[model samples]
Target chain A: MKQSLTQIHEMWERFPSVQKELQDVLFIIQDSLKANDKEVEKALLDMFRAGGKMLRPAFVIIIGQFYPGNASKLKHIAASIEMLHTATLVHDDIIDDSPERRHAPSIQSKFGKDIAAYAGDYLFAATFKTLAFHTDDMTVVRQSTKLLENILTGELTQRTNHYDRHMTLADYKEQIAGKTAALFVLSAQLGATNGDAPEEFVNLVTDFAYNVGMAFQILDDILDYQSTTKDLGKPTLQDVREGVYSAPLIIAMQNKPEIQKLLAKKESITNEEAIQLRDMVIASGAVDEATDLASEYTEKALDYLSQLPEGESKDTLVAISEALLERAN
Target chain B: MKQSLTQIHEMWERFPSVQKELQDVLFIIQDSLKANDKEVEKALLDMFRAGGKMLRPAFVIIIGQFYPGNASKLKHIAASIEMLHTATLVHDDIIDDSPERRHAPSIQSKFGKDIAAYAGDYLFAATFKTLAFHTDDMTVVRQSTKLLENILTGELTQRTNHYDRHMTLADYKEQIAGKTAALFVLSAQLGATNGDAPEEFVNLVTDFAYNVGMAFQILDDILDYQSTTKDLGKPTLQDVREGVYSAPLIIAMQNKPEIQKLLAKKESITNEEAIQLRDMVIASGAVDEATDLASEYTEKALDYLSQLPEGESKDTLVAISEALLERAN
Candidate 1:
């Protein structure tokens, strides 16, 4: 769908303030980080300039549009969520040994592991500091923090269970909720809190974000298996190389004895095995099944938007939910 | 300093409640972490049982004890600080490549790199969640978070500068202050804030803690070169092995030509090279100079205590400052 003028204006209005707040919080750490060595800062800044969709921050602002309070404070919260998302991506690259991110060299690839690790830490610290700017309500502080905690737990769970073919869809869902959906949920909740919405509205939006976030991740997982390398902007069968078994792969493993056998080995799968696994997943209709599941979650998210009092912000949220589904296909 | 029955009783009185608050926060994350994986929970609990000096929390409580107000609220603050400290240590082991921590296998060693990484993340989340329990004052949340952000920057600095011989004593001090002393200063400030002390007192105590914390770290670096392996509870030259050039080493390197040459290729320095560097550090009296600097900081810390109102808690702070110097000799 084409962007609405109102949506465009809202997006435009939000970006500069959020960016400024982000810069404000990050300045000290940005300056202090350089004190250790100049190379660290240069490499990190280069990596950070690589483009991101900033989907999480957009959601946060869309939610804030409903409440109409201190726009600057809400913008700080939005920037913080984005910073957190970015930090996780940097660290995830390290964990997955990913070289390319956002069509550019990952911090890990450019600066090596030690510098990448420091970059990730700096971003994480910057996120917390940005969030601290929204110090008016203890509840906001509490929830934002709890969101970070959940994200960490998800990361740990994924780490501990790496490469296990036995992981169920339930396990995948829980893990992704922590790792992927968590910031999404937090973004929506922060928006509601910024709006001074009722606690129930915040809860509903959080639930909506959670489901959509799960569907979003599942779609990504499916695309990882089904999409062309060019389309995905990365290698085919990347998750398997990183020892992460996603939902579609889990489903495909049920019937494909050969793929399962190949996956059980510690070494990288042969290119032939990777192709076979990919083809098997598409042929078995597991990708379709996961896509259908994602749609269900999207529908649930739309229902959440419908429940909110009618407004442009609410309508935009509904539109965004639909757009997110297109990400899967 | 002799043991005081009054101080011990006060600690006992405060410990259970503070622990309970920490447990509540950990329990939230544990529910999700331990839902499917029992190992994560079991390992974390084992670490908790290993028990730390809980110095950060104690500092929080001691400074807090001097002021008048609800003592109960201080529990969450102290617990949160301790949790942050725990999370930092968990990550530090990965960076330091230490095998053991607190007399047990480091989380990185016990659970492998992936889980260890997650465990650190979980603790980080838990720390923030604990902050959320403080529904009364958002300032507490904001200030505490600022402290955390500063500390993480410190860690990033240390990581980025690892094995660089060019780093000056000034650089070392800045890194240590951020990584180690920032939280110590925060602990005192948080304690003072909890007690509802005057801003001047809080500033004084924070300065005291900052100096004491720096002294503590400088002494630690000195002992790493001067003390036996068993006394330090790890290898004698562990920091140099990990590529961290401490203050004493920095000073020693400036004086010794051989040491300068040895340090130039120091990133891949072997065990023998590390010991040789350690000996050079000792022989140059740089260790003694570092110790003297630590003593000066310790004296300043005690001087701050003397300016504070007379109380048993104030006396304890003085004693702790003095004890920090003893760690060097």
Candidate 2:
């Protein structure tokens, strides 16, 4: 987390254009919100103020420079990516059935499910609206829209397979690809699409983004078991509580006979039982194995970055990749 | 309901272009559904075949003619409107918790809530994808996208105001604008845009479509209370069961103290209570009042049609307007 934060800070410090674009994107969304009724406006302001890490937007901006580095368009692209991430988080709060997020009452908890849903819808619509202003190229719109399609497909897969205990590691990977990595790829792809980068550079940067996304998500999964309730901001053990089986738990369940037995019982895995399973996951070397797998993805990301045309943006992207892999530790 | 069906049939019969576009739209949606997973494909097929009257597309075709319809562009416009309508229905099923629709298991019930949600998201994405292919005009896309924004806003408004006994007529109108009339208005506006109709013409046609939509929806509300279970292909008084108080109920609750008491009681309103309230609504002259309002809107639609350059399409549009008002009876 520390390394990831440092890398993000460096990227933010170096990219003045990224800062301006982000500001412009916020302006676009805020302008749209001004049309809402007073109550709706109040609710939207709360959502706006409950700021996130904006890591996804940062990734999008850094990668964007590899393609179209015009400071003007980068903000639109960056803001759009951030909006997508925010939309997912808003929806996730509902699906998780949690009452709070980011030290504030979750949108669903504060405004009710319907308002939260609309707020997400609003942001999603607003993101595209911003993009429409920035470019007339149908190709970009088509690709970005496809990215959203994949994300929803991933969400559906998660919902249908919840708590089944029969979900495979392959299926889990597919879900992550759809939900997490797809956006990263698109962010990188969009970056290149907007600029003079070669087609191969676009693909290479996309690979880097995808690998970093996978590593980031796997680390998130690891933290669900590894971190305490206070350290994570939200509740710990949320995935197990909500019936989501992330990579670490999925791997542990697959390899450990006792873990499989406990999962099959279908009773609430007590805190102690969850702790025992967590220990087994750690002891069986699956966490280490997962961490190693993440490192492989990180190295692949670095490999892609190494081949790209040399620039400060490229270096920042490589640093971001390193930060993601180190977060797993 | 019977009258609405007749109107739908009549509209299709009168317009060959509408027939062609309907076929093309259905085919396009079908082509979008070829998943590698057989089960998903089967579910999507079931959803597609769950026959609708295709009223939204019909509205598009009728309005397009007023603006000098191009048979080629009409296909894309009609298909996009229908796709948007279908997506809304899918999302509405999730919101309403409905188990059945149009005499078949609702999409959410059949595919589970998650898949249904994704299917809606997919359909929505496909709509933009299809639209993006046809044109890069920000005007058309902006109008269509704003339609979705309004629809979501209406859904949120309804959810927050649910079971509120004192909701104003303005509130009810706004909700209907978002929930029901938005797509109809979009259909007309998009048709005009595609047809290259003058801006004034677009305004008139969209206003006509909107009024017709309001009247149509009010009639739908009346049927929920007045129609029998078998006639509706649904259980009687189901709207009341779902806590969706409509205009008829609102009028009755205000005028008849006994009806108000029955609805306000802590217990669930019995079928008997629903019947009594329904009868009181009719007796209070509210049903007739709403019917007259529908007629006024119908006249306004006809007035717009009369001012248009006369053609067979104009006559059909007039017939459609008459049919819409006739539906309230």
Candidate 3:
């Protein structure tokens, strides 16, 4: 059964030790976004305040807690990861022409696409600046840089294959691996390395993160079809509208011949059409299948965690993954 | 007088040693841009072949030649700098809505703005990847990252003040310093430091590059008013049309009340109005003033070159700056 919001909040409350660290990460991000240009600064601040889950940073801190590490350095790496994620979102908003993000006007909608584009670039530069200035480990820095390259390559792949209804399940997996899993792996790897974890532990945590990220994204795509705009804080059926056929849609098309015909039209679907498509996807039980796949990945992640010694850090990591499985936003 | 294209070619011919290295840099760039997505690779390759002056890489190589450094490493750094530059151009073209670049269709024009935006981002990620993977010096990496931050800040400033006809000459100088001179400083500093030049030499070459960069941008802005589209490889009067009052326009508005009144309208200037504005800027002798400033900077750059040990590298540096002073494109 999906956890309720109260349950998710309770799980978060259990991680009070990292709350202060998370706040410090927020401060670092805010400082990085501050600029001499008031307009740019304001735009960035507003976007930051729109409030994300900051799951990547949370993962970093939680994983880092499993070993002895400088809390401050962990916060810096976490902040950098979050900034990079935000940068990608800024550009994604432009490409998707998204009007709202986190229940507020997106950067592109509020400040025009040009500013949105520059804001994304600014955040990217800030991410590197933070890493270069704060992180002492060149190996960590180099690995993070490689992850960014992979992330962008994934984005290019998605862009090139935009609206490719013929895209296979394997194609979807590859895209998400680069787009989503790479950062997750980076977050865990950085946390472990900084925490002075052994090499085997680092590898284990990285594998855990990859599974968790894959599940997380799969759940996210499922939510797009299941949740309301008010609940998700953004529009629904966006993936299909944008021609990005996610797991649910791809799975549904196999069983629902009508879906294939609908997707084959290659034109923008109307509100009625979108509703019909969503209903068909849900009715075809593809959402359940995708959710099951997500659960399987989440189970794999939990299995990896079970290999480590039992501790609060491990418990928090498990709880976070479980909450992600039930997360509505 | 501005030099002819033939003169620029002749100046380039003075540095045949770096030409082979430059080709290697190009190959690295091509390899970096290659992706599983053929369309993206092709677009990037087309942009590369459209041809740039490759002045930044040349600057890096020429400065590196002054000391003993790994040739391949120097080439990597040069390629990284050039890739960073090309990335900026891709974004700039989108922001400017430019149709042509280097006498060919721009990425935005050919592939659309979304793809253009991603291409720019891809290049930036590739740049950092190359630096992290190949360049062992963390200080150089940090400095380059900081330079990118400053460059983006400059871009934000320019965008915020897009058509501010009241922008002071000082403001213009500061903007160009961040937007243009910062990268030039990075190029020279990276080359000198990697070449294992002394601290004093690095500082001196960096300062020289700053002066040269300032002069180059000033001359570039002046040429937007003085040259034709055929000579420029893109539209002429683009700055004024886009409400980007460059050095000549800024200087002209200072002394000519009519020019100020004309510019204060704050709307996109029609071609006829652009021609009139160009004529007014020329008639007001602002072009001459801007030209004099460029020449002063070039002289200062040459003075710095003279202070360095007499060598072929020094001569090539001097030639590059002199060529820039009279360059039409």
Candidate 4:
């Protein structure tokens, strides 16, 4: 968490307004999580304190600046965007049966799924409340809620594809397109449109954001195979055991016979087998292949960023995109 | 489902406008569940068609009639209220590990908790989307969202008390106050105040709604002990097994050593012991004691109702309250 936090601080060191907006975003998030119930409050605050990169909220702030927008309004929206992301992560942990998040016990595992479920549900209430309270624009509210639907739909689709060793790279792309890219595209779109940015600018930034999100997710999938549990802030290769075929695994199994046979057994794949499968995939050089795919998208994102009128906002977008690519976890 | 529908249709037969709003409420709910993803939409729609009493939405429509509220806007708010209730029920089933709802497989049971969790999350999006779309009043949006927080807090509190054999009747009341009555009060308050109803009427109706909700919950608890699975539309006395002490169980255990001893084992209580506990609670006069307590709330609700100016709206609320009291399931 501090790794990306330091990166973000240095990257935004020159932009005082963006920093202020981020502070306000944090304030709004903290305020929203406060509850009349003590356990509810603590459960939610613990998750908040778990120290995510706050990357999505920062993306919202940075993108909002591409065109003129109200800082106060932007901060509240940014907070809502981040809260929605956090809420989804909480539920995702439960679905994946993940015991850890951000290097600590996950809400589901620590608090049990009962409190954790309520925590996620409560954050959702806070998410929309902040969004609706900040903006009078019904379009923004409507589209924001739809973004949530899109994300959950992506997750459900991913769930439906579990345990299929033959799951294609094409299917993986489609899943992340919904789960990851849609939010990024919207964060950028909302920021640009709220400022009344010209149509061309809005379209370009949204596309840029989309490509960036795709690349970000691919790099993340690679980290699962490459990074340690400490670095990743959670167990690695959990997705593989849970039958979620990430890009590297999907590509690796295409030519590897033993890998396919082990995964074919699904959950019956022993822990030792899972470790061997991970090693085999890494040895098969699918990690490098996945990195290449991520680079392609990063290049595409930069291409879109290049077409934008040169300014501080464009410069900041380029910096953030580069940093995401360089992330080890 | 048909039982309450027949009663509502007959009760509102004299007031066509109220019936029209209720019809529009259904339309809005149906529209909100329509999703871009087929699986998400199907899961949500199946839950919708599973047939709840539509009691909460009806409360909104019925209470709105006390003051001349705009039917169009009122229908939208009513729909959102019911959708929120449905959304909570979806999560509740997951938390309780309940297999059935309304005599059919619950969303969580039929679809599994992953889809069920998303379905609940999706409905929340729909809930806020519907609310924000129809009203310009930010207060309404903020308060409606807070209602969600209150409900979740109640649920978390209940979770904290799980397996406590010595749980009190007062504790049960506090839990239900947040879990059940808060929503009821909000429904009535929104209905009254939205139409520019007099404060005196609004206060009376909200109090009336609160008392009515308390009674409604107590009656529900009593039914858990008294009703058959087929009649209750879910397993009877499942709460006892789950360590959720309802009114009859709480009161019965206060004096019955056997009831307390059986509950002390918590989850280790054998299935046969749970059956015996349920039988003992029923054979005890605690069911009648719980019924008398429900009667007290019913009387208090009527006292509040009597203070309201004589009108068709008042009449409808009275009928609904009476019908709720008389329900076996």
Which candidate number maximizes TM-score? 3
Instruction: Encode model 4's per-residue lDDT on B1-329: one tens digit a residue.
Output: 22222233445565676666776777777777766357667666666656666678888888887677677888888889988998999998998899988777888888789888888898888888777777656677778877887898788778877888778888999999999999999998888877878888888988999999999998988877766778987765677767788898888988687878767677776656766777898788888888889888999998998898888777877777887886522
The collision pairs in model 3 are: none
Descending-TM-score candidate ranking: 3, 4, 2, 1
Error of 3 at B287 (Å): 1.4
Candidate 4 residue spans exceeding 4 A from truth: A1-21, A134-137, A193-196, A254-259, A309-311, A327-329, B1-23, B134-137, B255-258, B282-284, B309-311, B327-329
Q: Which pairs, if any, clash in model 2?
A: A21-A75, A64-A191, A67-A192, A67-A195, A68-A194, A68-A195
Error of 3 at A165 (Å): 1.7
- Using Cα atoms with residue i matched to residue i, what is each candidate's TM-score against the true structure? 0.85, 0.89, 0.94, 0.90
lDDT of 4 by residue, A38-127 (tens): 766766666666666677888888888877778778788888888899999999998888988888888899888888888899888888
Q: For residues A1-329, could you state the per-residue lDDT of candidate 1 as single tens digits?
A: 11111122233343464444334434332443343345656665445444455568777777777667777677777767766777777777776777888777777888766566556766666666556654365666677667776777667667777888888888888888888888888888887778678888788888888888888888878888767777776778888877888888887777565667778774567667778778888898778787887878877877777888787777666765777677554
- Give the per-residue lDDT digits (tens) of candidate 2, residues B141-174: 6677777777776776686677777766667777
lDDT (C-alpha, whole model) for all candidates: 0.70, 0.70, 0.82, 0.80
DockQ of each: 0.41, 0.44, 0.63, 0.60
Q: Candidate 3's error at A186, in angstroms?
A: 1.1
Error of 1 at A230 (Å): 4.0
- The prediction achieving the highest lDDT against the true structure is 3
Q: What tens-digit string does per-residue lDDT give for candidate 1 at B178-201?
A: 878888988888788776688889
- TM-score-best of 1 and 3: 3
- Candidate 3 residue spans exceeding 4 A from truth: A1-11, A327-329, B1-11, B327-329
**What order do you get sorting by DockQ, best first?**
3, 4, 2, 1
